[model samples]
Target: MQMLIIGGSGEMGQWFATFFKNEGYDVWISGRRGRSDVAEKLGVRFTSTPEEIIPECDVVIVSVPIDITPEIIRQTAPIMKPGSLLMDLTSIKKNPVDAMIGSAPEGVELLGTHPMFGPSIPSLQGQTFILTPVENRCEKWFPIMRELLERHGAHIEIITPQEHDHIVSIVQGLTHFAYITIGATLKELDFDVQGSRRFMSPVYEIMLDFVGRILGQNPWLYAQIQMQNPEIPNVHRSFIEQCERLSKLVVENNADNFCTVMKDASVHFGDTGAALHRSDKLINAKVAEFEELLQSIGKEKGLYHIYSGKTHVGIVEKVMARSVDILESGKLVNLKIENVRLLNSDELNAWKNDNLAAKTRDISTYIPENADPDTLCHILGKISEGISCKVHDTYISPDGRRSATFRIDIRQDIDINKIQDDIERLLEGIGCILR
Candidate 1:
């Protein structure tokens, strides 16, 4: 099967290229610059324009930013062959999907998709891909698309174009705006991350990591996420109003009123049940801190609930020596931990069953392929600026295969080629094979 990736040099585009290439498909990437950077890196063919590549492909997956999605669909529609599928990966669907419906030629299939994760996760092991099929003929391509995604481990969800955008107005649109605003606020405050690390709590560290993460994503992409959807501004308005309510409660020093508001919001946000409470390490540290500060303290264990997913995985009625509030029996335990990064489903389950004390890898020893000691350290410094994976160790085997493991918890939907090519290129520079 031939797959053509419009905007093929983009991060997501590169991800799809690597994915199809790995699956032994004929993958060709086309982009505006006419440059084939991603295809070259993945050792796939590349084209400067869709006109040169579109007719030859069975599937055309457009991975351009949301703002340009409509124009891209218009450009691509006239050129797509009949019976061929044309789909886009834009986050907001209504406009682009509508554009595709209006622009696509007769007998051609049109669909819209949102993979629901960044290129950070390549495997799609547990990620969801939302699909909105435009017409009846589009049904022919749905199973083909689903099969390819499922082969790479993505969960599929089908929704209409309108429903897709309205829901994402909250999930993608609101969330992106909030994170960007927080990142900007931090910059304005001139918050020194280095100094803060000296007194880091798990929660605080996680929040800092989140700020850095959203900040590192493409500025233009984030801007598109903020502006492309018309419903986002209203969501943003509601969020700000809620913030005002919280601030008013704090300023008035009405603890009871604040608590009531929290209860009401909690009831509205139905408990997902899979939330983490405190890691065992965190709880112990908190207890120790309280003991040091107070002369007298209770000696009763706190309630903890372990979660595998939406369902309750395990629960700890007590930890043997610290008094704590027991909320619902099957209620979420870690509902208050902000900026908490997620683990893959399997790792999460393992850690939860083990009571969250699982050993984490230390990244200091990791070396990059053929990188000078100084360069390796610099690369690690750059990587440390973000919240995701970190390199663990780099080694070249006797047979010439070079590899570097990482200390990161991998997400199912992350595009590994983004990093894999870096490693491969580095190894090739050092005259090593991938084996």
Candidate 2:
């Protein structure tokens, strides 16, 4: 299958390019700018002239900014071949869906997809994917695409384009507006953000993180999200009106009215208990990680970097609120606690096996006449990631029993004696005698 992403130079587009590539598709990327370097990094072909490439592709995905999605779809959809699929990876749906349906040829399939996630998400697993398929336009390929996404662990919701945009007005519009407003308030008040963290509670800390997260992203994309959605202005108005009411209640010190407002809002919100439980779990997880770091002082621990996917094994020298100092290879490396995860023993061994070279040791042993050395070696290999086994040599023993030398390959930076002991126990259980 050949998949072409129209805006593949962008982060989200590059993400999908890699995604389709992993799914065994030949991915081609097209960008308005000279971003062949982006394609080179993703190991996919880049086309400066998407017009020539559009007709030949089996699937064409438009992944540009939301404001320009409809424009891109109009320009690209006409050149699409009959029976091919046209999709957009944007947050908003109605405008793009309308553009695609109107511009695409009679047989070209149209699907409006809103991947309810950011480019920072590694994979589709546990992520939400919104699909808005035209009534008669997607009968042929919709089921296959839906099943494919679901099989890869995505939660799919089938909705009309109108419904998707309507719901997203609250989901993205209100949430982002609230967080961005908090940031604006801080700036206007000249609040000391870093200094305040010293006296912050867990809820405040987590809320601050949410605010920073949105503030750190592409402002243009956020601007498009806030501006392009037709329903968002209404959301903004209601949000402001409530904010003013709350402010008035606070300034006037009307305790009874404030309580009444809060209580009414809580009732309307529904299911406060579940929200509390989930929040508590999040807070507890953070506390637990902090406790682990404190206890790991002076002990060797493996920390896995989130973005780089690299593991650093070292003795913990000191732990701070947001970072840790590790004594690795006689040098102190400071890693942000938020950017890394603590790797357990098994995870550390697995990382070692994948990232490090293996050291081989030959184990010569004798077994029963009916024993198969190849099977035994495979079993030994399965016992742990620290070691893998292969039959090196085979011969007949003095008592007519089978004899074999197993080549045990050990992952670097692991305990050799421990692996040897584990292999010994398995060999003994299978009735093999050491030479």
Candidate 3:
């Protein structure tokens, strides 16, 4: 059997293309702008005109952007052979499913799929794929598709397009809306996140990390998700109404009412203790991972500076099996290795000479909106010779301005003034401003 994926250059399209090709199907991808290199890398054929490929393909998966998916479906579905299976990998199902059902030839099978995970994931293990079968004239295709997906460790959930949209309105819509609102509020307040780290708890840090992750993604896609879903307006209205009601309780200083609201919400959630236990496990795992990373660095005999989540600098005297020995202001302290970061080692000699005293500086800067965290960290590492840089906080304004606060560790030997100047210059060269 042959499979063709439209919009093959996109992340999801490439994922499907690579998967089908690996499954020994004759796989081909068609996009407006074909990249031979990408096709070669995925071991699939590529073509600019999808129409030419439609007649030959036994299965055609439309894996384009959400907004353009229906148009693509309308154009390709009629051309597909009667025995071929037609599918779409859109996030939302209703519109695309309808388009596929309406435009496909009489005997073509139609299935609308939404794979919950993105392309960065290595495999589909533990991932959810929602399948909305619009038409299944080809009786054998649905089971075949299910088996293929399950073989690769994907869990399939069958639902109608309307049901999928309703659930996603809360699952994707409300969740993204909440985070986006928090981000906007931070931007509006001109919050100094890096400066506030000394007061942050692990839970707050996790929330901020999640916000940053969302803002780092494609804004257009997220906007489409919020705007295109017909059910989202109702969800947003309900959310806003709840927020208003909560604000009224706070404004009136009604402690009893607040308690009542909390009780009601807890009851609605239905398993507070179990939820807390699960969350605690995840938090513990994160802490363990953090400690393991620091120990690995210490094992390499790398001279490094450590920072507690409190944003305080500690002199790492030694990394032990369970804890790290540090000197904070002439006081020797043992910290759980997971609670500290061995992020900087450039001025190890200077720190040693100064009796392990490290100076902490909060440097605020602005980078291009939506810069990759890894790339930004790499650039900072290259420019700052002896200073360890950690992103204490990042926020993006509504107008697309992205700002970050970095915590830099400076040793006594390095000239603090000159280093600051060098950092400013390097940042400015990369279209970033030192604030």
Best by TM-score: 2
1 or 3: which has the higher lDDT? Answer: 3
Model 2 C-alpha RMSD to native = 2.3
Q: What Cα-based lDDT does every candidate model obtain? A: 0.69, 0.91, 0.79
For each candidate in turn, the TM-score is: 0.63, 0.93, 0.69
Q: Rank the candidates by lDDT, best first.
A: 2, 3, 1
Model 1: which ten-residue window has the lowest total lDDT?
295-304
Error of 2 at 204 (Å): 0.8
What are the per-residue Cα lDDT tens digits for candidate 1 across 1-435? Answer: 888888888889988888878888899988787776657778999877668788778888889888888998898888888999888888889999888888888988988899899887738999999999886868788887789888878899999988987899998877777878887877799987668767887577656777778888888988887788888889989999999999999999999999999989888877534234445456566555444323222321222223323422333222222232223245534332122222334554444445433223333332335546445435533432122345667766675554555453323223444444554455456554344
Model 2 ranges with Cα > 4 A deviation: 368-385, 397-402, 412-435
Q: Evaluated with lDDT, which candidate comes out highest?
A: 2
Q: Report residue 283 deviation for candidate 2 (angstroms).
A: 1.0
lDDT (tens digit, per residue) of candidate 2 on 219-308: 899889999999999999999999899999999999999999999999999999999999999999989999999999999889999989
Candidate 1, 155: how far from true, in Å? 1.2
On TM-score, the stronger of 1 and 2 is 2
User: How many clashes in candidate 2?
Assistant: 0
Q: Write the per-residue lDDT of candidate 3 for residues 4-52, one digit (tens) a residue.
A: 8888878888988888888889988877776767888888888877788
